[model samples]
Target: MALRKIVVLIYPGMHPFEFGVTCEAFGMDRSDDGLPVYDFVVASETEQPVPTLNGFTITTGHRFDEALDADLVIVSAGARGGTPAAVPATLAAAHANGAAVMGLCSGAFPLGEAGLLDGRRCTTHWRDAAALAARFPAAEVDPNALYVLDGRVYTSAGTAAGLDLCLHIMRAEHGAEAANVVARRMVMPAHRAGGQAQYIEAPLPPAGSDGLSELMDELLAELPAGHTVNSMAARVNMSPRTFARRFAEATGTTPHAWLLRQRVLLARRQLEAGHEPIELIARRSGFGTAALLRHHFQRHTGVAPTAYRRSFSAAGPPV
Candidate 1:
């Protein structure tokens, strides 16, 4: 179905950045860029003014009634430290009607209140993941994911991850070409998978780990070529078994996993920059064949290679 109506539910103590993510994705007029225009509205329980987390106030003229028939209903973060304030029942009804429901950051709390998250895989900010799960035992909360989607309900981690989920929805609904236009206008990455880790904070390695860093850099630079644990260990002048253990300690991920991610990242960069044949990109990105590239690319990004390129390429839309 064509998505045309979007309603963002706002509450007291709403964070401006969280609210703006929805507005930037759907409220802006992008018809000039050949994108679809949505009937976007910021909704509240009452039409009264709502205080923001930024020490300011915002007023929306719409109420819960306005969201009853919306194609998508988005819950914005509330004030009380990721614990939502009173949520309207209309949100539950909208979900029952099969409208796409999304929760941005702490917004997932309201969905839980509405009982929309029961038996669903959802996620919130890392800090609140445990709380959300504790509050709603039926919900499966994944703290590491950037976002989560079970059926039509969507939830994201803190802050900018909301933008990622929004763009993914746009891409899925409107196709890659249309989503790419909006992403380009906003100057954001066109796609980020829901399965990606929420936070990748690794402090500087200890003094002796410098060698591993240099070795990893070399491996990254030589991604288009064949690599194995033994080969990498030989390059680093260490036993393969010892290299594997040290590599995991330094990178916090296995070598093959790291290589796969790097290759996919490189392939996506090339895909987004220009019109390149998928096979050529596959070869350059070290996937060896278009089929292999497609397998890993889809596993990582939740979209096929050609579709991904079509979503972000500067040339005309994907065929």
Candidate 2:
């Protein structure tokens, strides 16, 4: 059998985790596993040393010309919007040549810029999810998804999510047994459905005053249906203006953002358990309507409530 070539794109300010994931998954030698061998190489847009966020550097031995010839090409994520990726000519060539392509983390930005994400379902980190949605309204963006496979193009939610997608890819290319062998060697999970949603919620700060703390916890548990900001502020015996400022600084995010994440988390547990219909889930999770639950659920997990339940395929209803 012919050896499958795997080429990974290493850009400046590249994430070590993302690149390491590719190397660990596809770049290792596994001839003894009776699997088709992979010829893996790290190539760069330029021949110079690639800088990383931790101030370390990795030198690339090959360039775009060699990378474009690979059967699989990976674009890795890095600092949020810091490293401006050059849509290297080799990437277009790789796509043109019919190679399976993938974008991980902020790596999706470059792919989007190269028109790779056009007319395809994709995902990125939740922090940049809103921006991606706003930027590419026509393109379906799932910020909360661990990864998304749209035809030949595969995109993962954030840096860690890359591992999930790679293992998923291995399962597809080989099978459960093969994927398990590779995963066991790496001390990672062998199977996480590509459609499994991402759980990225910003934690709220502990309440300063006793009265406010109790109220805050309840509000989080019962989100949209809970007390308003003013009501919360009154519970702590403070003005709404003062309370909002304190809350923002304490939580490191606006109340609205924090609340949305908490609510989404609650809804995910319920959806996975297959406890109720969309309307009940929406009401209990504080979204108030099925459409509202779906909007946030889709934003966070990359799939609708019904789809999420169906993906489980366990004996009983969702759990």
Candidate 3:
């Protein structure tokens, strides 16, 4: 269904940034750029002022009933407790009435409380994934996805991921052009490459000079060159085994894996920039052949190169 009306649920102790994501995505007037301006409302259970997490309050006149006719209803991260009964009741009603419902970060808790997540796939901040699963045993929770959409329910990971989910919805319902326009207005990437896994905290590798940095720069400069670990190790004056160990210690990934990821990123940029043939793009990205590029590209991005180009190319649409 077309998403023209949007209602953002605000509550006491909710994170302001998450709520702002919804507002920024749909509230502003963008008709000057030929984008649809959503009928946006900030709603609560009552007409009272709602306190935010950072010692401030927001006054909203709309009530949860406003969500009943909304095309999209958003729930941002709320307080650290079970959802209020009224919140869930409203969400349940909105969902029953065919509104596309979304919960950002800990907001997924409310959707779970409303039983909207039951037997459906969802996600929240990785830190809260285990707790969300423990609380809602019937929901399949993915800790690594930036966002998950099952049926009419949508859930996202931590703060910035809310924007990703918003842009995704825009892209799906409006078109890539609209999403790209929104992303440009927000000064963010229209589509990110990886999921929340890349954001999870891990022990940083010890800071030191491993020749790997220079080698990587050289490789990036000449990606089409046939460079193997043995060749790389020889250039760095080390045995292949030693090079592999140091590479892992320095980058937290195998050399081959890192190279493949870089190649895929390069391929994505090439695909986004111009109408280069798949064979030419494959050669430039060091995949050697179109079939190999397609294999690895799909494995990493879950989409074919041509499809990605169509969605993100600067030209209006791929021909």
Q: If scored against the real structure, what TM-score would every candidate get?
A: 0.69, 0.67, 0.67
TM-score of candidate 1 against the unseen true structure: 0.69
Residue runs of model 3 more than 4 Å from their true location after superposition = 193-198, 204-319
TM-score of structure candidate 3: 0.67
Local distance difference test, per candidate?
A: 0.83, 0.75, 0.86
Name the regions of candidate 1 deviating beyond 4 angstroms: 1-7, 17-48, 60-73, 79-84, 88-101, 123-137, 141-207, 314-319
Which pairs of residues have clashing backbones in candidate 1? none
* Model 2 TM-score on a 0 to 1 scale: 0.67
The lDDT-based order of candidates, best leading, equals 3, 1, 2
Top-TM-score structure, candidate number: 1
In angstroms, give how far residue 188 of model 2 lies from its true place: 2.0
Model 2 per-residue lDDT tens digits across residues 1-319: 1228888888777778888989988887788888666888888767788888778999977877766677878888875554444543566678888787888887777777667778989999878888777766767997667889987778887766898898888788788898889877877556666666675545554756445567667786567576567777887787988888877767666667667778887877777676577899888888899998888877766667777666453435434
RMSD of 2: 6.9
- lDDT (tens digit, per residue) of candidate 1 on 171-234: 8888988878888788877776788666344334334683887886677789899999889889
RMSD for each model, in Å, please?
Answer: 5.2, 6.9, 5.6
Off by over 4 Å in 2: 1-3, 79-88, 202-213, 216-319
